[model samples]
Each structure stands twice: as structure tokens, then as C-alpha cells.
Target: MFRRHGLRATAAACCATALLATPALAGSDGPGAPGAGDDYFPGYGNGGYDVSHYDIQLRYQPTDDHLRGTTTIVAKPTQNLTAFNLDFALPTKSVRVNGAPAQFSQDGTELTVTPSEALPEGSLATFVVEYEGVPSTVEVDGIKPWIRTSDGALAVGEPEIAAWWFPSNDHPRDKATFDISVAVPDGTEVLSNGVNTKNASLAGWTTWQWRTTKPTATYLAFIGVGQYEISTKTGAFGQPLVTAYSENLGELAGPAKASVERTPEVVEFLTGLLGEYPFEAQGGLVSSEGMNFALENQTRPTYSHRFFRNGANTSVVVHENAHQWFGDSVSVDTWRNIWLNEGFASYAEWFWSEAQGTGTAQELFDHYYASHPADDPFWQTLPGEPGAEEVFSKAVYDRGAMTVHALRNVVGDEALLDIIRTWVSEKRYSTGTIEEFIALAEQRSGKQLDELFNTWLFTKGRPPVGEATGVPVSATRVAVAPPKAVAEIDRTHALLHDH
Candidate 1:
């Protein structure tokens, strides 16, 4: 029973600004709330406990797309708890609480557990859930979770994909460090977030151990297991830039390698614009898996094989990589504020295009303003308040980009970069709400932006720009260095040697 988009929340009528500042009040003595009380996905994250780390060990069988795993979740309850819930979707064989077989029952996606002893406030606890089944992606409102590749699997758990593969808190706000080990047969390699500390072989199988010490939202945690041509390159700060592509991608592998090879160049560009690259290592994956979209999965972003097309531009590349700063590192407090991710990344594309000397952000902003009629759904929809399905709609991507451009027009480029740096520096590795972001903007720009935010983010219909702040500083058409076309890669020989 999947809905097309997120069902409208029936909870308290809360706006993005209101939903973001929700404090985690200590839980009562009874059972915790089945849901985390997130205004967007009520069935998502759980209450009472806060997760600190996840040690996920998955043994995958490619023949039948089956996965067997034991997930170890380390958490601390905020209040005394007799029972708590975890979001798990795979068929579980057994469950244990801190090595004890706790009484448990499953209802839908929620796995409710009553521990042998009641967990008191500030008490540490662990849950080990043994699950095995053909983990299918959660499909709702057109957004699908994991992608089942031809040979193995690719797990990109944005929104609710993690629950489909592992039992844990399945919301963006509940971030945790991860030690992910995906064991696979020889010929298939496992790629995940952060640094690859272990890749040891035993008999016919290899275990790939990836550790991300940085706290990561569940949505950004990813795993890709497939036959790949892995490449390592030196990036900024001399971190290894690791990329992988499915061998079966055929000609698609060429553009994929090309796009991925530019990872260093993109990181360098983004680092100059936005403080620094947020993760330890930067890399990418190009796969035959048929998820048409690209995800900003923490350190390594994943792209579909389709984007390797000759016509496909690196704007998507710029977009997803920009998410490393906007989405991955500085997270949204609620799904309602997803525009903070999409909008910033989308605006980064405009910045890239402007830097490339072809189109100015001003020109792109004007074109959308003129081309789309006033009543176009793109302009009519609000990013601060999106329905389940409308999360990534034009309001999120295009108009979101437009919102950033409008900000740039308000504060000059230098000041805008200052505001951005302040945001990422202060909110890095943490969740924030729209109100906080608005306050930061106002403080940095010394401009009361209630009208501006209300016009662009909150209200619907075409946003009006008062004639005062509409004028943009002179943007000369200067060719940005590292002269690779948006769609074309400078390196061609990289593809010839891909094995």
C-alpha cells in the first residue's frame, strides 16, 4: 500500500519554520511514540532513543537478489522506555535486544520491541535485528528506494530506502556514524560512504568495510555492490577520489568515466566557492541500475547510466556534488525543508553555468521568470510546503534555484558567499530549520527578509521582486579555467583503459 507522494500530514498544522524547531522533550515512562513526530513522514523515525552508530553487516546473494544481515544499532534513550520502535521493512527472522531475545512484534514497517529490562534515561542500549529477504525498494508517489541492479544491488536510502534494507531510525534528522560491511562474491565490489578501511578476501568472497565517522543522515547512507572498474585519483587535500562503474554499462561507461573523472575538478571548484569539500574522500559511481536520478550520497554521489549520454551535461554533476555541502553536511531538520537541499544544489548549477561564461545566473533567472507563465505549476507550487510527491517538483529544483539567485541579487556575490560560509560552518554535520536559515540570512545581509522568504519560499504564485533589489551587478562573460565543456570531459584516454 504505497501512495504516489507523501500523504498529507494530519498532525498539528505546522509550517516549515514551526516544524524545524521542535525540541526533543524527554520521553515519559510509557512506550515511546511509534513515529518520531516528524511533520512530513509520521511513520518514519522513532521517539525515545537517539542513535549514535550503526554497524551493518550484509551478506548479499546476487543470484536471487537476496540479502541477509544483522544490524547493530547503538543508541541512548532520552527517557525511561519499556518499549521502542524501529523502522524495518525486510522480513526479520529473529530480534535481540543487547544480546537478549527481547519480546517483539511486527506491525507494518514498525518493529516494536520490549526489552528484558526497562531502559532508563541516559542508559545505553543496543539492538541486533537478524533479517533476510529479497529487500525491495520502497515505492511511493513515484520515488523508489533501492535500485536492484542486473547483477547485485545499489542501496541509496533517501527518504525511506534504508528501512527497506536495514532496521534503524529511517529519518534524515536522526544522523549516526556508520561502519558498513557488505560481503559479496568475487568479481563484485562493494562501495559505500567514507573511507574504505578494509577489503579483505576470504575464499570466494570479499568483505568491503567502509567507515564514515561523520554523522550521516540515513537518507545519505548508501551501498553499491556490482561488477565495476574502480579507479582512484588524488583530489584536494590529497584524499583519494574513488569511482566505480558497472562493467556492463557498455558505451555508457565512457561518459560515466568521463563524468566521474572530473570529480577532482568539481571538488576543487566547489571548495573554492563553498568553504571546503565536506567529506573525507570524494568519489562517484556510474551504474546500469535503472534509477534515473542521481543521489548525493554523502562522500560518493551516484549517477544513473543515462547521464553518460553525449547530450547530458555536468550540471547534474554540479547539482549533486553541491549537495555534499547543502544536503549531506548541512541537513534539513524536516522533510518539509527539503528545498534547502534541492534549492542550494540547483542554484549551484546556475553558478556553474555562470562561471563557465556561457549563461549568466541573471539570464537563467530571467528566462524562467519569462518562459513560465505566472500560473505555471512551477511558480504556483511552494517549496516550504510540498506534498509527499511534490518534494522534488519544479518548486524544489527550478524555483528553489531561483530563490538562491534572488538572494545573490540581494546581497552581492562576496556577501552571499560569506552568508553561505557562515551557514555551512555553523550548521555543518547538524540539522537546521528554515527559520534558523532565515534568521542567519537576515543577520548576515542586515536585511529583514520576511517578505522575501514569504514570497519565494512560503507563498505560491509568481514572486514579485521590488524594483530596488532587482538590479544585478555586472557579470562579465569570462571563461572559467579548466576548460571542459559541461557535458564533455577533458580526459578521453581514461575510458580506453577502463577494465
Candidate 2:
């Protein structure tokens, strides 16, 4: 999502060094974690509440190009209410709550449901919604999905396309369990979050049911349906898993297969470094699309054909996988705080780079410093922007990566890792803010970090540092003036004589 702006050149130099020298700070309450009650602006709109759990059973027939499903939502009222509202993504055909027909409204983009009864606070209520639609091709910033020629693979990106085939919140702020049952054409494969508990063929189609025990952000919930070959593996806790890819790209699947095969190693490495894996099941899916990047959709990650070709060289896989901890487990409360997700993901790239011994961690910082544009406007951006577009810019990614680098430098690797592990373990299935992160960092680092955060976050531009130092340098200078005209000289002489 980094914009290639020419203006970034000026700041790039400073960002590189500043990132390395920046100190670790306490985790602060900068922004709330996803699914946490909306505290930013009260009474503006309903936050991601009222729905505590989602049990969705769906059927997808690829041949008919149609999807149908029943979604049972268990919700609790966060506030005292006479009426209940829930937001659903995509086009829905029929919806009912507690077996009674429920009235619904839609604006094409979002479907809102109004329950008939006033559910008291802390009381649980259930609603069922059914819908079907021809899955819309995934698009982001006008980019269309295409099968990758490198492997004839297909993958989805740019948010909840699973909801394109179902009815649910498309935002990551709402994390809930989903029991997805997909029925695809007999030959095609179906994959989703969590462990695959059942797979059966019925009515000329294959029905795959995946029960996710772990709570997941809506965006991370997913399903990849197509002709795919499966590969199996195991990770920590002896969790059984599999990686899927198109049959045509069997040869090129090596790297992707290797990457998937390394899932246990990656999980162990991260768990030993950050914390335990936060989800019940984890795997990777390789698709034919040349989307801009890969998506870390909770348990099952979707990757572009490019990822499989270069294998581990594409850090997008690592970045997305890291979200299982940052974006999926803890979650970002709003798009404005997308840095909490993107920044951490970008930082994971460097963490992996450091682990691979490709270069010293400092080298990673140098890369960010050299690549970041000087004129990047993220420094001047307000946190309450409508979408996460600005926050996901390079400033948040690279600069944020540098922030983590600086923190590691200040706290030392062991302490930093400890803090990270603790944060994930403690905040699992919950939400947190930048301030909260800062507090955790300070508590773990045993040092105050306000000055550090100020230098990197609050300033209008990169902090003046040694590499891009703004120090004034003295230089020999000359002053020149226009020569006086003869008429002016004569006038001055005449006036002096009169005096």
C-alpha cells in the first residue's frame, strides 16, 4: 500500500537513521483494539457490539455461480436499548431472527437488520440471516483480481470476500467464531478458517465444514474454492493443517509448499519470539491472482502467485502471518488506527529478515530510511480520518517498522520480545491501543518512552538526526551591492560641501 511519491526522497535519509536510534516507549492507549466498544466518538454510530458470536453454515455451488447460507448470530446488548441494529455485508435474500421473520434494510454496501424486540443489556439474543449472490470479483483501489500465469493460481485480497458469499460484518473490528460449511462443485476444493472437521460430497457437490474455535476478525475469516491440491503438515501443539494450491502449478508450488511446510517452524520461531500462535488452525493458500499483495486472513492465508515463485523471498507471507497475532487476535478498533495492524505487519518483515541473516537488523532500518520519501505527509495526518488509507501509507509501514527497530535497540532484543510475547498472550481475544502498547513497552523496558514517541509520532517530520542532520554549517560568504552611479556620487559630495 506504499505510494510511490517523489517527495519521499527528502525524508528518506532522515527516517533511516532516526528509526534505528529511536527508543522504546510504554504501550499507550493511542487507539482501541478491534471489537472493543467504540470509545472514540460516542453516539455517532453503533460500534461493533450487539453481536458476540457468529455460527454460519453456508453452501456454495461454483457451477451455478450462486452462494446460499444460514448465519445464526448470538449478540449481547452493550448498551441499554429498545431496538437492536446489526451490520451485514453483501446482498442478502432472506433474514429472520429467532424463527420470526425479521425486517431488514440495505444500502447496497451494507445490510442493516432491526430486531423486533428490545434485548436488555447483558442478555443474549440470536438472529438468523440467509442470502445468496454471485460472488463479486475482489477489487481494491480499482485493481481487479486475475489468475497468475506464474502458477495459474487464484487468491483473494482487499477484505472480506467470504462475506461476498455470506452475510456478516466486513470489518476486522468485529471478531467472532464462524462455523463455515461450504458446498462446492465435486471436483473443486473448499478451504476456510479453523481445522477441517468434516468433508463430504452430497447432491453432486462437496460440502466442507470448518469449525473455528478461536475468535477471529471478520476480515480474517475466509474461504478459497477452486481446483486445488492439498499438502499436510503439523505445528506446535501437534495441530494438523494443510496448504492448498491449483493443480496446474504443481511444479511452482515448491516455494509455497516449502513455506507451508515451514509453517510449524515459522509458528515455533514466532511463538518462541513473540508468543504462541493465537488461532486454532493456521495454513496458507496459493491462488493465481497477481494482486498487489497477500492477505493474512486469520487461519488460512491467501497468497498471490508471486509468493509461490520466490518462496520466502516475498515477505508478504510473513507479514500476513504475523497478523494472526496483531490484527486478528487483538484487532484494530477502527480504520484510523490501521497502523496498529499494518505497522506491526511491516515490522514482522524486518524481524524475519533479521532472522534469516540476510542483513543485520540495522540494515533493515537503513532500507526503510533510504526508501521512505522525505515529503511523506503522514506526519501531519490526523488520526480520525474516514478510512485507513492515509494511515496505511509508507510512513506508517516503514516508519512504524523503524519505530519497532528503535524500541528493540532501547529495550534490547530479549526484553522487547518478552514484551511482545506478553502483549499477545495478555491481549489475545481482546483489543488494545497505542497508549496501551506504550504502557506495556515501558513496563517491560523499565524506561519512560514519551520522548521517544514524541520524536517519531507527534512531530511534523522525521526527527533531526546524525545522518540527515539539520545542523547549521558555517560557510565563507560575500555580500555584493550595485555600484553607485556617478550622478549619486556627485549629489552626495554636493550635500556634504553645503553642510
Against the true structure, candidate 2 has what lDDT?
0.58
Instruction: Give the candidate number with the greatest TM-score.
Output: 1
TM-score (C-alpha, index-matched) for candidate 2: 0.77
For 1-499, candidate 1 gives per-residue lDDT tens digits of: 0011223443453354235324345856867667766666767788888899999999998877889999999999888888888887777888787789998888667888999988887988899999988865444334446568778888874676787778888777789999999989987888999899989889898999999988899878889888888887787689978898888888787767766788788888888888977788888888786565678899898877766666445776787788888988998888788888888887787777778875677776766566566677767778878765577665677677778888788777887898888999899999888889889988998887777778888888877646333423322223343224322321111221231
RMSD of each: 6.0, 16.1
| After superposition, candidate 2 runs with Cα above 4 Å error | 1-49, 137-163, 310-314, 371-387, 466-499
Q: Per-residue lDDT for 14 in model 2?
A: 30
C-alpha lDDT (0 to 100) for residue 85 of candidate 1: 86
lDDT string for model 2 (374-491, tens) is 5756445432232333444445665666667767766778887888888888888877777778789889889877766656655666544432221111101111321222122112
lDDT of 2 at 221: 69
